[model samples]
Target: MRVRVDDASAGQRIDNFLVRVCKGVPKSHVYRILRSGEVRVNSRRVDQTYRLQLDDEVRIPPIRLAEKAAEPVVPFGKPFDIVFEDEALLVLDKPAGLAVHGGSGVSFGVIEQLRRQRPEAKFLELVHRLDRETSGLLIVAKKRSALTVLHDMMREGKVRKRYLTLVAGRWLNPMQHVKLALHKYLTEGGERRVSVNSEGKPAHSIVRLLKRWQSYSLVEVELKTGRTHQIRVHLSHLGFPLCGDDKYGDFSLNKQLEKQGFKRMFLHAAKLAFHHPLTDQLIELEAPLPPELERHVVQVEQTEEKEYG
Candidate 1:
């Protein structure tokens, strides 16, 4: 089958376009076909990273798909809290436990639900991602032009992202800079994990102490370089693991805290600032700490006051 790329689908990577076009096809199979030169654009072979342009002719090879079971449905009634919106973008306060887009093992996620809610929306794509366990501000591009410019800004380090988190112990330094090289590896059980390695990608984070308790410290972290699991791995390596972080954290402490009703990850994406892709105006946004996390912080402060008073 062949498709002519339209404006709404322009600026998206070919692989993503194929994944969206081919219903019920596994992602690996789509990638395999692309690598094997089965997929073509304008009668020429293009790699997955090739972005589709308006009026480009894409040729898709037919594949036999197995009978798949019906997947679960996302609640169309529950829409994400929109923090900011214009013709170019949508900023959302993403809740924890929801994947950004469907893939891996998840069949549906925020993007899918958003598209379902607004079928008339021609172009919608994630600007960046947060781990499913982490919650906070997330950006979605409403236009292909917005997506392209925002992606360029990310690579140039023009976007400012900050997070709030509670660490396992009292932080001594008023400010700290962590520059760690992180390497990604698969566990024996096939689980993905990141660790600090000598030969790895360089990551930088600046952390500032916000408050201190006997057993935990609240801190704000600014990411200088974005890498998978960068914040969690860096803090864990410093012996100040994030409170309630399931991976790269203190497991025993997590279980103890869960029993005490502090069950979720303490990390939250509190702030985001970047220039508007179209207007070129600075866009600054913030999401107040979720009620649950705020309550936990108050409890810790109260306990410390009782002890020190």
Candidate 2:
């Protein structure tokens, strides 16, 4: 069967395009078709990496759908808070402890739930990502045109992302720039982890100290390069691991903070700004710190005063 790529589908990899259009097909089978040249773009056999263009004709071979037992039911997810919405985009205030999209043993996440709730939406895709434990503003694209434009803005350094985090140590620098090369590797347990290494992808984060207590500092982090665990790894390498960060954090401090009612990682995506993809209007959005995080900050302040007084 022939399928025509539209503006929204343009720029997506051929393999991803196939997976989305061909529901209930195993990923292994999708790659097999591509390798066998049964999947063609514009009458030419292209690799999975081919970025589809507008109006490109995709040839899909017949494939049997997985049996009902093979396809597990995706549980319904309650809708998250909507920070902003329009024809082209949706901004959500994602809470901590919810995965943005499910994979790696997670059954359902924000995107799946949103799609389930808005079954009539012709297109809905995550413009960017957030860690499962990180709470804050997240962007979802409603149109393919908007997704393409937003990606361009991010590449050109036009997107501004700011995060708030409380770390385990007193950060001495009022303003510090961290340019560390990071390498990702899986632990023996098969879990993903990143660390500072000489031979790795370059990463940058600008940290501005906001407040300090006896043993912790609240800081605002601006990402210059988006890398996996960039903020968490950078802070940890600098001896200021984020409070309650299970991975690359101070375990003793995390336990102490938990006992104090600070139960989750103290990292939050607080602000996002960019030019509207379709309108070219400057857009700035903010997600207020959740009550739990805000209250922890206040608790830290009270402790600081008590100690200094």
| lDDT by residue (tens digit), candidate 1, 193-236 | 99999899999999999999888899999998989989999999
What are the runs in model 2 whose C-alpha is more than 4 Å off? 1-7, 10-15, 26-61, 66-70
Candidate 2 weakest lDDT stretch, 10 residues:
66-75
Q: Which pairs of residues collide in model 2?
A: 8-144
lDDT of each: 0.92, 0.91
Give per-residue CA lDDT, model 2, range 218-292, as digits (tens): 999999888999999999998999989999999998888889888899889999998899999888999999999
Q: Cα lDDT for residue 139, model 2?
A: 94
Candidate 1 clashing pairs? none
Best by lDDT: 1
Q: For every candidate structure, what is the RMSD over all alpha carbons to the true structure, in angstroms?
A: 3.4, 2.9
TM-score of each: 0.85, 0.87
Candidate 1: stretches off by over 4 Å: 1-4, 12-19, 24-67
